[model samples]
Target chain A: MAALVTVLDLSLGPLTGDNFVIYRSGLRWLVSDGHVCRAGEPIAFCNIGLRSSDGEIRSTAPFLREQTDFQLTLAAPMPGTLHQLPDASRGGWLDQLDRYQHWSESFIPGSLDITGGAGNQSRWRLIFSAGERMTELAEDRSGRLTGWRRIRRAWHGERSDHGTLASLGTCEQNGVFLGEQHDFSELLAASPGSLHVIHVGDENLVPAAAVLSDRMRRDAGANALLAADMTQAVLGGPVTPGPADWHYAGSALSALTRCPLSERYDLLSRQGLSPSVAVNAVVLSVNAEPKVILRHRKLGYRAYWHRFRVDTTGQAIRNWLNVSFEALSRTIDDIQTDLRELCKLLAERGVKHVLIMNALSTSGGESIFTYAPFSQALGDELPSVRMKELNLMLHDLAEETDIAIVDVDSIAAGLGAAAHLPDGVHQSGPMQDEVRGEILHILEQRDFFAPPRA
Target chain B: MLLELSLPLINPHMAHARVDSILVRPDKKIAIGQAILELTVDLSDQFPHDCPPVSYYRLCASEAAWLRHLAIAAGEKAAVGTLLATFSKTSDEAVENCASRALRTTVVGVTRQWQPW
Candidate 1:
């Protein structure tokens, strides 16, 4: 907007007097000749630019914006600092507002190593601690509100494996400022499957965020609907070395930064930026078993890397994996309690619907992850919340109250299991699409998001 | 009398611009004619080019009673399209807020006789 203002000024000359005020307020384009306010009715005062006094010509140009209920989510160079760009040639505020990417959620279940406490740290593999919260909510630092783009369908028709390394590396293709701690160059180097330069002690750039982005993109089957959206935060960068000193980020980085959507224009059509979407629900793990992501502890930067345990055991819990009967029952009981509390908290945040996504019942006896884990082995900790049984419980609950229940069981059962999940704890790549799809199906079939009629 | 207005810019079928209001007091009689006039004056300044100014003149009480007897001649003169509204009070707060911001009500409800355009 600032750049355009300058260009327009150079071309059109100084807007003398009230014309300046009109242009500055963005009302120069919308001034209407006259209007009527019948009696005492008050309406949202929009289109101030179209309003005109008497019957004189004010602005003779088309409006700067294609006025719709569209909300713009400005991503990057620090979304919070659009008004303060140090450089102007790359097109400052005007170019920034018309951003390339839309929304992103990066996750890093950083390495977990208990032996580090005892000093044998370098030898251990970094544990991929799961993210506990279902979703992390944030906005552009420059005080922009993020809104949902009422999408009728997912951008990709069929979920495809765009490659894990590729997705993680995409974020670094274009420079990004993670925060005050890490810059984009380091992040780029960390991605592309090599992070020898990044030590575990310097936990900023390399964390579970890279893994989460890969999982989400591959699992969700698309990079952010828009590229370079700040809504997402990265967990860990891939370990890819480069020539000389420049970073070598891979595919996921492209998926994160400005590759997928930038490469394809159709995906952006479904993307919309808004102030917010009413959601803060838990992504409970339906299965009691946990998936472990293997990560390397880039040693030498610090004494030892400590294990960070993300008990994604709670909010991020998903069903479909095989677990001890006790673990499954215990997890469900705990998750139910958490949901009860979430309902109270979410109500204050204006959430009306609470959806529970059903995990695929893939452990129908032959799954590898379920082989060692049958409830019969555990005497007392028997699992009660099995897949089919949980669906019935959810069905019964939905009938009893307004709490909406999304039956992911029937959908996933027909679609089969995802191949990427380790130990069958988390969802596999394409399976996530099937999962999100089935959930969306149930959501649409049922009145999960039916806005109240005014 | 309730005057139904249709604004074409809005959906024509849904053109009834509703001014939902809650009058706190109960059992108090409000002159409907005065209320309608107030509204017309309020919207007087809008749509100056397409929608012409309406009902610029008002009638005094003594003249109003006499005009009502002469059925052949007098009516509210504010030209809000074709329909001329009849009212008791010339102005209300709602009217003042919506009236032409530049036009000053120099004399309160002066009785002015004029031919309908």
Candidate 2:
């Protein structure tokens, strides 16, 4: 059918922070669907070749998702047209092109073309994916993304539409408007019913902001200087959350999922903590589910209660709090004792064993967490002092018990973009997923929640 | 507790009262894809108080249709599984919606004044 046209927007679009969300959600969905995919993988979807303006922006995706290492197979039932582009000369942020573009002729914009077959197939992407699927599809590896030289990633907060679903246009309108000019929907749908894998040359599309985020994350991000710089970036302008941007909400959520109780409470409150809240956290063990419980303050705030079950011989993770207002030192001891008691309770309940871990907030990407969008008048119920107390309790408990809280603070500090927390109390959603994986790694190491016999 | 395997078992833990997953009583089947059954927990009748405190539950769903049973439990007196979550593919909003309703339903009783500070 006229080789379905597609346009892959390689124009350093700003990120809406939904990319991480998509990544986490996609990861879970793919895993749940029994598909093998990794986080941070760029996804391309299909659009029926219908166009609104009948111009360049085709209604569907142009480049097909090739069976590459980084990209997953999105087509159902049958395989789609595939393309394997040549290797990149340098892996870097698109700024390299400014030198090559108007400044230099060698600035080969990061784009590809897909042809269904040799010579006869029509070119799918006129700008990004210029041609069609080539025979070398299998020759290139998806994991080869490691080869890119990775220039500094620039955070383009603008340009991505993923972040502005409510703020901007709908996917359908974008499909038509951007399609008439350069619609991403067309690029996703260009290759009809096929797995098209396009190799990225020299230029890596992993967003510069993500790299900067990574660097700052590794640096503890708490340095006031870094926070100021980030604030400047947000104000000084990254890509305006537009069509060009990709939201990393998936990864953020994934990262946040692994947050220790001290930090995760805010995220859990997103669904409007009506006292009984439901949160989707990835379980570390195959058959073992973590003991996720709702804790509440007792009459006159004397104590709080959390109730969960241990699968006979299964030991699960739980967050225990210290109700005392004693000095951090004295309260710390009490928190530790409480954690030990809880673990002992689990042990007695036939829970094989328990692992206690403490959690702390990283400095990077936390400023964004300050505002509560869901809060009608800005739910200010949870304050820093309260949060600190929770952290202290977790730490104290860790000292007393064996289930050491993984240094989520350091790891989060190292995770630049994924850890971009909006507030000190809680992290962005994408980070939750990353934290979940990190905790899973911890679980695996201890052989705590081992996969039961299949 | 004993049912087929075509439902999605969802166990969401809020606060302290947490229950991660719910595997049918007899068979140790991991209630995934098609092993979950449809469940409806009535919050209005479950507890005398509105919005029982604890919020958490295990979810199991049907494969083709996202029809899953929600094994919601709020060990705390404040929260209970008051609303029912309908299952769907792609987006799993049913449970979250029900949970929100459950909370809002119960949150009305207490006098919560907003302090901007």
Candidate 3:
């Protein structure tokens, strides 16, 4: 007696728009043929575009701003062995351009073979992702989320509305939020409900407390002043501005002008396009905090850039930074005050939950017996000492504010820092999974997915 | 008594570290908790992170000792077991061909602020 085999046909399900038709490129397979895929795991993706059905394009079409780099990834509806259809992909430029074919709802690009029996789901789940490129020339169609984008986002669910969570941290927080794929696959796979995640890169400007607060409170007049200052610095400065100098200056200005916390999103789902409120929760990294930051001398604005990143900038921009900004040293007390101000501003915007990932305090190499020889202000002189003190300050702040601290320090200590956290900032895969689990736990505890009150 | 300070395994992923700067000099008496040398551990090739995990650490003396001989200098790279320096219990003690043991020391993380203005 042979076992009963059930084959499920996966189709491009309903992705509706009011006055436009959906078009897509050839299939780009993520998994190989005959590979068993778990439910909710992305199996394939393709570039997508919208076309006006009546040849009358309106000012606002679906994903208008993100039309240049709009893409959709297909998630497995049920667990089974995947069998890709022969004509699904034509290879090369055919797979790159979205205008190659119309996205038919009845088209079956793949099938799944289940040994025993199949689950009820036969329709392929759609996960839409889009990236607003930092520069139009930064196009990378090689892989998923493969481009230099200033603002990249992805959303999934069947609900009419979605909850937004913006990740504004350094590489450490990016590893936890963006996952190993450099996409939101790990975070999205763990989340069964609806979520819209926005990730902003930290190459030009770090999202420290003082920096973010300054951005949030910056008015139009201040922005104009900043623009004038930057223009004058680049064009009138002593150093000659090259192409790289202009590029770096533009990116830095873009980072300084936009506030990720105040930006809303338009999410596409089964119910069509619906507006999501500004981020309900924000995840920050204490590692982004620096002992010293540069503040614009005349403008009275703060800019906290990593030393290595600043060193790599163009000579003109570096000269501009050197002449225009003054170094401001921040103590543990300064950091705490800046964080409290940020939380208060978030509260005014109706944002209640703020989760900060604490710094890894222990190095495992330190074997200090006494603190007699060290300076009285240990946090000011020692890096590990400063991190430990910063973590402590976060705890004190949490007592009064509506913020929760994610304990990366304790987790790293428990798992052995030498193996899991080699550089004290980045983590191994297992370590990231552990940190992700803690984040999910906190999100669940705070009922972050509950329906918004009217 | 002679003490030998070789590079310990400060980070598991590092094969070797580059000496960024030397804090103490030969024939100088270093007290406990005094910084000896600064080294950089870069795991950019060993690990798969978007940003290279390069860290700076300061090797400080845990036991008060007189610095006798310095083997490695600033800008030199050393392996895990490469001897960094030799120390003695007394400042005037001869350190020629003496049996030595591992020196008691602490590796503290440090930060370098770039001020190119």
Candidate 4:
């Protein structure tokens, strides 16, 4: 009988849900190809970034600005065979979309590794081992391997080839050897079948969803779906606005020292800046050109002041205010509607299990201020209020549809105000744990996973 | 007229709940939709076993009323429909009746007792 492969497709993008890039940049690969990793094991290290003191190749783009000097590491998303795709170094700037499409097409469903990274530094690595003996390895600064001697000895005790480097390298490829190579195919063949839990959310859901997908793969042998750059679809809003609508902010100190916006953009593009890397570059433009700044200031003051005056005087401002609100409402409604349609489509495709995460509220209750530049100019209360309304809509939809709602708000609220960063949206460890736990609970309730092998 | 607010059946499977905290106090005027009390529903027996047995829920007031009497104290578990509190139209009436229900109010298991209001 053919071995059943459980391929987990992770679709992550820059600015998808909550800012997963910060976590993604920090990830360090742990398990090799066809290696087993247990649930909650540190398969990869995330939330750590790369930094160089020599000021090597720092792009002036806002996102890559800070990355020029330092970087954070993100954790390994799941447990499976680590199948790393070709690094971005092999492709040029224009070839990225094509490269990504090819990677997705070539991906065999049920594999845990995901594709696409920011630049040459970022690449896809997957964990394919579901339920095998987890061999733990240690490494030093020079990328030398340690601790594999014991595992090798244990697997091939008294064998003539036990301590050989060639044998060690071979053992690393598939699974541990008890005189013969133990491939993951044997374990997978024993299972019933595979199911895919496609996560559709922004960056916040990325790391948590990845971990949850890993857990599901380890415990239930299901394929957790992920994608690169599905933010616009999941968020139901414009992710990359035109340069004209982009807002730029800077501290007085930064403004003084900052290079011109055009120069910075040129520097960034010259350095092979990706859309993911451009997220912050668009916002934190410290040295905006004088002309651009003056133009923006005039436009901002005129638009805001006029609107404020109109609002206070009980008159609509060119009916644009209502149009913006209608658009926002429509966007939120479309998010729900799109999710429902996605769920229905998945069900028709024989996917009975679906988990949808509701949009989480910012910690300080100020998501509006954070998104002011990209979104329409609305009062402080509107964004928060609309978020609550969207969450409520999700709850109602879950009850009516086959989809199960993951209460991200409750998880955020449970963690208290300090769990959130100053930005009020992005979360780290505690929040990730909460969201993961909630997803696991939901999956368990649905009986999504198969019974563990005795 | 006096109105009785019982421990509502937030979840159909919820058999018992512990009062996590009380947001409102006796003789305090609370508006409609204001949180009255926080309840930790005991979900140990529900599906997805091994999860946190208790889920927190904030029971809010559906109608505007003055909290008259506290029947169940914080950290106490009561069956569904247990009298949680009583409300009246006026604060004076609530304050006047607070003394009568003082003996019945048995406080237990109260932790992080906070009055943000």
Residues A1-454, candidate 3: write the lDDT tens digits: 9877788888787776545677789989999999998988899888888779864435666566677678889988888889999888879988878887987888899999876656557678888788778888888999877888887888784555566777888988777878889878888777645778888879868999999999999987888899999899878888898888878888889889878776656666767767545688888888888878889999989998776666566788889988889988888999999999999988787776799999998766566676666765778667788898999999999999889999999899888888888778878888988898888788878888755545
lDDT of 1 by residue, A1-454 (tens): 3322110000111111222122111101111122221211111111112112342333341121221211211111100111221221123333323232212212111112111132322111110000111112212212111121111011110111111111111111111112112212222222222111111111112222223223223322333432222112121112222321111122223323331111111111111111112232222223321112222222101110111111112111111011100111223333344345444544554444445544444332121212122223221222222444555555655564445554445544454533332222333434444444443444444444333334
The CAPRI category of model 3 is medium
TM-score of chain A of 1: 0.31
For each model in turn, which proportion of the native inter-chain contacts is also found?
Answer: 0.00, 0.00, 0.55, 0.00
Model 4, TM vs. native: 0.27
Supply candidate 3's per-residue lDDT for A256: 91
Error of 2 at B31 (Å): 64
Per-model lDDT: 0.23, 0.25, 0.82, 0.34
lDDT of 2 by residue, A1-454 (tens): 5875342212222111111111100110111222322222222321111112322322231222221112112222112223222221223422112122111112222333322322322222211111111223223222212222111001011111110000011111122112322222232333121111121111111111112122223323333343343234333442343221112221211222221111111110111112111121111110011111112222111111112111111111111122211111113334345445545543443334343323343222122222322243221222222234545666665565554454445545665523343222233434544543454455445554323334
Instruction: Rank candidates, DockQ, best first.
Output: 3, 4, 2, 1
Cα lDDT for residue A395, model 3? 97
Off by over 4 Å in 4: A1-126, A129-332, A362-381, B1-117
* DockQ of each candidate, alpha-carbon based: 0.00, 0.01, 0.53, 0.03
Point to the candidate with the largest DockQ.
3
Candidate 4, position A164, lDDT: 11
How accurate is chain B of model 2, given as a TM-score from 0 to 1?
0.19
